[model samples]
Target: MEELTELVQKYSNFTQPMIDSLLTEIKNIQNNYSYRKFDVFIDVRNDYSHQAVVVYHKPPQVGVSLYQHKVVGKEALQENEPGVFHALETGLPSIGLLAETQENRLIHQRIYPIKFNDLVIGVTIVESDISNNILNSFRAKDTLERYNDVSATIQLFGRLDLAVTDQLVDSILVFDKLGNLVLANKTALELYKGLGYIGNIIGLDYNNLSLDGTNFKSILNHFLKVKVSKNLVEKKEFQYLDHYFTIRKLLNQENQQLIVLIQNVTEIKHKEAEIISKSVAIREVNHRVKNNLQSVISLLRIQQRRLESPELKQALNGSISRIMAIASTYELLAKQVSDDTNLASALNLLVSHFKQLNDTQNITVKSQIDSTIVIDSDRIVTISIIVNELLQNVVDHAFSHDQAGTIKLMGIIDHNIVTISVADDGSGFALDQVSTSSLGLTIIRSYVADKLKGKLKISSDSTGTTVAFSFNN
Candidate 1:
């Protein structure tokens, strides 16, 4: 056994504690059935095929040895010993299987999967005395009966394969037709322990188990009955012992069995709550900023009313427009569920405000925008200011007092590039007449070239003028 442990530790990925536990369990099994021989086999995968190697072998004292020679460290092909490979692959026990040993002696074997952390790490093979006919016949019959019972029970419970169920980290509870708890895996046991349960809980009636202040058994009973009439399973979440849990109900109609799957979602629920709280906090911040900007705008309006100089009033109004443009970005952000704003929507609001402020009844403003052009708040602010300056330039300089004209705002997206243009069909100016140092033009040029990393193109002739900006998506 010590030699076997050393080999297992060297070749397998199992920890030392796991190896010790396995050795202890194996010793207990050997001690309980002293009349029978036992051998432990581990599946090893090579480049070609899977092989089972004998790591430990114990022979019966009163019977003829199944193998005349030492069988430890022997390798058996998967095809030759199907029981070992079957238990390893299925994570289920294989009982009463007859197979030939390395020395050509027939042996009766019961192979059980050894599990750790919901994984099949190895197989434990129990060999009985095959030379005694009466004993062999009785053992084989009993094993076959037990296997049938287990197969039938599993089929009644939605045919859930124990091989897969044993590997799940979620706690599962299965109840029989009479509401007796029949199955609970290691995770389920640990979870029940956390709920203040002690000792073995198997074969207990569902209603007999005590849970502090929770009607868990009644809830299970209600769901089991409700599922039959409504054909709807209930899923619920609750807190138990400071941990959040989600319970799912599954019913097997054939035998009226019930299965409950419980998942601990404490961490996941906490993260969701944190995200929602952050979103609310950000929205409140945006609202406060918009209010503060509105207050500043109100103060500016009062100052404009008191000022007698037209030039000073005009300059104050320009500052107000720029501040309003920033406020509009925050307004859009406050109303949105996400951090991004629709460029078309924000620009449309800005354009409407400018038209009302300038009172442009002769110059008709038309917008041809791609509705899908949505951008983040920062880009929205920059683009809003650019559009505001361009539209102001057209309203103030493009048309005469008596002449009526059309100003068009165009936005288009092709492939991944975005292009926005402001064009006017009114009196045009020569390219050389437009000063680069002018405040409005300088703002537009600096924002386009520096902030947007885009190119600004201005074209003017005798008929019309157009300013277009192109940038990456």
Candidate 2:
């Protein structure tokens, strides 16, 4: 308890008295709920990251131990322990959040915020062992009750003299073997009225009902006569009265009766249409952006032809390459349905384009990029620029001797950090001789450190030069 208090004081701004009060409350909870393991965690806020540290732990007396080892100083990540953070963020108890311990054992956790003067300072988590048998037993009992209720409702409909209740949200109608309406709920009666029925539909023949000169009754009669397998259910959707409706047919024992259910799904259909409209709008925007960028590239090429100075032409070529890198991103985006762009595929495409455009007669370019690495489209542009600059540097300076060489681009992701390296097997330069003021190197450094929030490492020797960048995703 003393160590837990000191750890909380070291990580949080809560006073000693407040910490002591919280500890006492946790101990009382532990004494009350002796079957569950309880742990107190305080939020540790830092400039770079927000974390929670376990300040106190109490193990259960009669059940399996949730934590075999001490967690008095362990950090709880929001990703791994959402219930703990949720309680702290909302100041409300979070219940029944499933999680796995460091040892990979699944447990059910409930978290409550520890407050002092209406200000939440920490959270207390109650973890319990998950018993599958107990859960299955409760599920079975609930299922049985639902089945019994449905059976009772169906039996009530089997009696043709009874008037069914309209309490159900869905329209329910039961048809006899002769395609005669035996029972119809009030919702079903209202729907039939909309279909141009003027009188009682309880005794009306389904095959005689006319709907817009199309025997809609014949469709229902045909379904009633169709030999469906026992316990088989068929459903279909149609549009009516500017609303969407789903019809389901259920076959009872020996196909003696057919139960029809209708549900209105107009709101769900509207949501689906909205999603499609948004997708089409996004694709149209991508298409327009790509076309505009291509026009810019064409104008740059035309201007480059008019320039006679070699240095000016080279600078223009660099600018064109950067623009082309950005254009490639939109090109890929226009072709994809998803918002995330596969960085590996995009980088490979960029490398191939560079090799084809540049004058590398005997140079071989190889890529070891992971195809599974995908990132958002906005970040993809920065990554594309970074990759283009590093690869262009290799082509211009690494193999300036016109000797046969190889340039390899490798990318891998580890623990949410993406690492990309461009290595070349060419004449390497001394690190001390490299100028920090070089435009290409400076750009690479800026993009890596500032834009990506990462670090860039460049190593060079007689063997080769390898430039690597690491960033969090």
Candidate 3:
């Protein structure tokens, strides 16, 4: 049994040459066994021809040798041959006659099972005479099947797992504890530009690739700073035409091995730089325009007092003030191109200018303004005229009833249109009772409808009059 077990292990990977050697060795053993005991020898086996060899031990026959690899009948032993047929079919042991001829052939055959572990494999046919004892065949079979099961399972699972793993999507990679590339997926082939070093990392030893691991430590430091996921490492940075990546170390759930993921982030970095450059340019342009408009306003105010008539002097002063109001709005816009104009700041400055001009500190002006709106200079100029005209009307007519009242100025922007209102609390005026029309209100109406392309609404209640206007920029 032990001898059969040894044979099973040794000849597990059966080949044609090994089978020929086994047949010759058995024939020699049989001849020695019979000749020493009974002075006679007998042997039988299929030869190169389709016919079976049946020879008596007394005289050797002149024919094809039985030791040849090609066993004649069916490229193997004949399937109809009793012991050989059953042994090959079920990988089990059997014993039967080779031939029924008197002096033609009568041999004893014992079959020994070949196994990997507990699995049944094809049997080994041991040919001898009837006296050699056939009980050894069953014992050999029992010993062979004891350990072959595990070996068969291993072989089967290995083939199936390899087939399934080939169909994965992303390229998976593995590295040894020494940081050598060991395993890689099919996608890695395309990713590495066909460098043909998927499993070896091009033999780049850490000492060779990095000077005392400095390069590796730099990469580790970059990754720690970014702290992006191990799977999603962004531009940690760009190098020449390529980009270097930093990824966190991850442990594989099944193998507990370390891994890192790499990607390119060159495009996003370029876009961020472009946006910042454009914003800076925009802010600079806004600053220059604001400075230019303030210079023009200063020139206009200096020339206004030279006029002789009181009406001409007042008209020039009003125009200069409106221009200054718009310049103030631009000043705020130039400070933050990223933020926008502060309408409240512009309103406060406009009210302060009017109070200075009237030389009346008692006029209480309240303002409700949204500072976030980014209105253009043209819109600001138009809105300044509208507010100036409304406030002038309040100061001239609303307070003329021997009463002091508060004025409220509010501004709001929604979507692309900005709405502004100037209202005063005082006695109302009758359309039939009023005779003279002011040139400031006439210019305000023309600018709102034609130049600013806006709508205006004026309502006179018992408390006071409200002037509202909206324009698009």
Candidate 4:
């Protein structure tokens, strides 16, 4: 009694007379509340705004206490106990209202005002167990006791106490062993409302709300049938009403409760579809470009066949080879799904194709590139033209008639710099004496400087010719 007076004085804005009025009601509740088999308390408005503090507590002496421990000095929130605040502010009585206690338990409260000189001083609350409400619920008899035992454990694992779960973006639901939803967070309830559910979803059968039409019992059985560990979680995607969802389901082995988490993924699916549509369009464009280049090559071959002079025939062949080299890039792009080609494979393909088209008993083209690389179609087309010119120049000028020679293509990469070298074991010419007006020299220098954005290096000796170019990879 003395502590109750001190509590009112320390925390509330009550007058001395109001404190006495509250203590008088607390004394009557402490002595007579046991007959009702309920927990009783007195609450007064605190000096802080919109809160009340419990000043006295009395547990039933005849039966089990609904509260596990004393909570005399605990604050009562309006969200949890609106009835308690109603009695204190309006000097009226609020009866049979469901309220959540500070210990996270639910009970029915009956709050009555304590007043002095027509001014409300405090509220006296009598709280009883909610077993009668549970009796009317459809949740199985075994579910009630089992859910109580594991509800705290589930909240701990999810980091979702009731207060915090209301603010989460992910919808969370927990079901009992009987396939009934024992708990649902505020987000889940709102999600169901968006899905056209007009009523509360708690205590409802889970099959009614499942998007995939998989019953909860069958889901549990499927996990066992797959020989998966009971602790292993299963994740899947679902669509309902044009909304895409990624759902994860897990079963708590200790209590056999099922937990479901759902997230909307519609925007992600839309983006993926857009990317695939663009990829198909790109592949189509590359195919048409390859066909057009091949047609041009056919026309050049026809012109080469009509000519009798060796110089005219050789000139047409050079044009055809350059077109063919560029065509190879589009051909590769059309065959694969990705937009970029492997650099090593593209270079090797060029080497193999060129050797087959111009192979001779006196001339051999070999690839000695040891490093692996990948590049895009644009750069590969430029490289193809460059490498073909270098090889053609070696065939025409480096070796004399009836002379046997070998050409080796080497591609090396070091610290983001790639160097391609075409070395030929043929009679070489002097670099200073060579004509600047030479067509092959002009093509190589212009393409390397402008298209490839790289440096060109040439070396010649009495024994061999090596033409190399370097670019940033």
TM-score of each: 0.56, 0.55, 0.46, 0.59
Off by over 4 Å in 3: 1-176, 181-249, 256-258, 353-360, 370-385, 392-405, 412-419, 426-455, 470-473
For residues 132-217, could you state the per-residue lDDT of candidate 4 as single tens digits? 55535533565456447676745546643333343347787888889877777667877766654423457766655575546777
Give lDDT tens digits, candidate 1, residues 1-473.
68778757555667777777678766766676543544434443222334667767766655566667887666765545656665655566656555667876666677777787777667777776456773445345444443357666455443654533543688777777776666765688787655434234465545433222223356556766665532344566766434688776566565566666778788998898888888788888888898898899999999999999988987887778877877877777777777777778988888877775665888888998999988877788899889888887887788887689999999998987889999999788988877877888999999999889998999988788999998886
Please identify which of the two predictions, 1 or 4, would achieve the higher TM-score against the true structure. 4
Give model 1's TM-score versus the native structure: 0.56
Candidate 1: worst-modelled 10 consecutive residues by lDDT: 207-216
lDDT, residue 260, model 4:
84
- Which candidate would rank higher by TM-score, 1 or 3? 1
- Answer with 2 or 4, whichever has the higher TM-score: 4
- Which ranges of candidate 1 are over 4 A from the true structure? 1-167, 186-244, 252-257, 306-309
Error of 1 at 380 (Å): 1.7
lDDT of residue 122 for candidate 2: 78
lDDT of 3 by residue, 188-287 (tens): 4354432211122222222221211123344445556776443432322223212233332343323423343333344666677778788778778777
Error of 2 at 322 (Å): 0.4
Task: For candidate 2, report its TM-score.
Answer: 0.55
Clashes of each: 0, 0, 7, 2
Candidate 3 residue 329 Cα shift, in angstroms, is 0.9
lDDT (0-100) at residue 405 of candidate 4? 90
Model 4 lDDT at residue 13 = 67
